[model samples]
Target: MGTTQLESVPEPKYWHLKTVLSEALDSEFSVGEILPNERELAARFGVARATLRQALEQLELEGRLQRRRGVGTTVAPPRMGVAVGTEQRVWPGVGEDAWQAVGCTLAAPPAAVAAALETPREQSVHIVRRSRVSHGQPVAAELLYVPQTSAPELSAIDASSEAARARVVLRELHRLELQGQDSAVELGSARADDARQLDRLPGAPVLVVTTRYFAEGRTAALSVATYRADTCRLTFGASGVEILHGQERQAS
Candidate 1:
């Protein structure tokens, strides 16, 4: 690659540089390849280091690059197509689900979750924590809330550990006939717990997916999943699209 001076344009210099860098990424770089240092990049583009930094930050926000602690900046993988909705009728933790149950606890949910669950504010519910990984990287962390009313049988189970409690809660909850599910997606900043689970810095951009599972004419369970916005593109509808790091495939 040769040094090329950027021409002045009406738009911000960093924004224009971002465009040029994006093109170069496609034509000259491979995924996971570390980019040159900021000084080198600035000198090559004939832009100030400050402008180059701005452009790099924009690229990282757009999921085109990753800034690792020790690895520096590298080309990021393509956005993974995460299926948020499907026609198949099934409960979570059932039948080849991508999430892994990490732990479970009994705690009063947040006010919004309590309202959604239609439980008293002080009532403790079963909170099942789960995490999803793709390409060996954590992509999402979830909190599955099951009201005691939703999984009454759990009371009888002698769950000795957190994982055991999670299993029993899931088992009892699955006994309910799954009627349907609905989900809503919105932008969010990673909270401390979610940030740790997702391996992102505090306040990093995230996509919050809130889902309600229905059974017996009531909201049986609620799930709040936090996905790394840079790594995920939420997909809806029955026809699923599976996007891997560097490839795309269709799933039905």
Candidate 2:
């Protein structure tokens, strides 16, 4: 909102504001540092409160700021990134890991998941739901699908089975070479169920990462993970150079 010369870079005011706020958070602002109220910030910037709020939203999406009901906005600490790859099934929260499974079910799969599993639309697959929390907030929710072929040994699994089926499915999958996987990301809103599991409001932005596992030239499994864009920066590759635009950005 701050006035600038015409020759200045052509960028949205909110984008500029987000950059300024991000810089402040990275340097002057400590974790949990309470920022000036929105009204004060808007007045100082010479922009409408709504405009300033938009800027704040972007910063919050980058995990730079967090706002509470009664409390003002504050700096949020960095979020940790758990590597995503076609690797062994490491038990959630059991191997000193950040992933934790909260529930499991065998239900009719979504069309996308059903296609990936190469199974009949009517057939059900094990949906292993897990949550990944870093610092104090939930960062991600994962839905791992286990096709019947991949879990033939689960016939004995029951309601009180203690997540044994999920464990067994992952174990069988690990035996293969796990040669490669194909993945695509898209912007999506959190469904009601995912919202509850992720501790987010319905329709909140999420980074939907879909993966198809491969072993010995055949499909192994499929996993769809929805990460809270407001609290996570998904890192993928050698040095994590991808932009933090969430699911709303155009593919590069």
Candidate 3:
């Protein structure tokens, strides 16, 4: 008879450490409470510093912890739920949108954005930069692209200043009758500019949202917003109830 061999299951050290630290956070830590320094924690857990840090990074990504450059890590508050889908189709900045425009400029968008907008590769478009703040912390950064043909009424006077150009482009966009809108969300890493706006390190985990605005039977504009995955829960549709993180799970 031939001997049979069983495969062994391998579990990563960092994953196990992440679970232990997560449970500790739930039972023993309070929001805004600082954790022990990395070296001390690693020693206490009998794990390498790099292993401990990997666990910490996972906790931060789940919004269970917050880490700053110079300051030590602390327990994070519950993730804020931002509404992504609403019943009415309205232009961005038209209603009670949370985004605040920072600046605008004329530049050629990325290839993906150009393809979405159906604009020529060499054509310059209006790029509006915006940021979102939640609970006094920056949570997201957005780049809104408007093709020149969509906002023909914008004059050279508005182009003199960044803020002026942003307003002008939005005003012209509102003139069009919004037919529909569609959006998709995916995981991504923050780029340099987006990282600066989100107050995170480069390559930090992010939730990238791509939205396309339709008008006059054509694509009018495209918006790409990157939300801090560590501190945000992108919610769709309406729900009266809110879910609190780090709280004990109810019996199922």
Predicted candidate 1 versus true structure: per-residue lDDT over 103-158, tens digit per residue: 89888999999999999999999999988988789999999999999988565557
Predicted candidate 3 versus true structure: per-residue lDDT over 1-252, tens digit per residue: 111111121568788778778888888888889999998888777778998889898888887887766778988887766667666788888866778888888888888889999898888998998888865789888999998888986635336667767878888899999999998999898899998888888887889989999998989999998998877787776432122233433221
Index of the highest-lDDT prediction:
1
lDDT of each: 0.85, 0.67, 0.80
Candidate 2, 159: how far from true, in Å? 4.8
Where model 1 places Cα greater than 4 Å from the true spot, the runs are 1-7, 39-53, 153-157, 239-245
Candidate 3, residue 102: how far the Cα is off, in Å: 1.1
Instruction: Pick the TM-score winner.
Output: 3
Question: Which portions of model 3 show Cα errors greater than 4 Å?
Answer: 1-10, 238-252
Model 2 TM-score relative to the real fold:
0.70
TM-score, candidate number 3: 0.86
Clashing residue pairs in candidate 2 are none
- Candidate 2 lDDT, tens digit per residue, 18-118? 77767767777788889988888877767778878888877766667766446778776665453444234332233445566666777889987788778
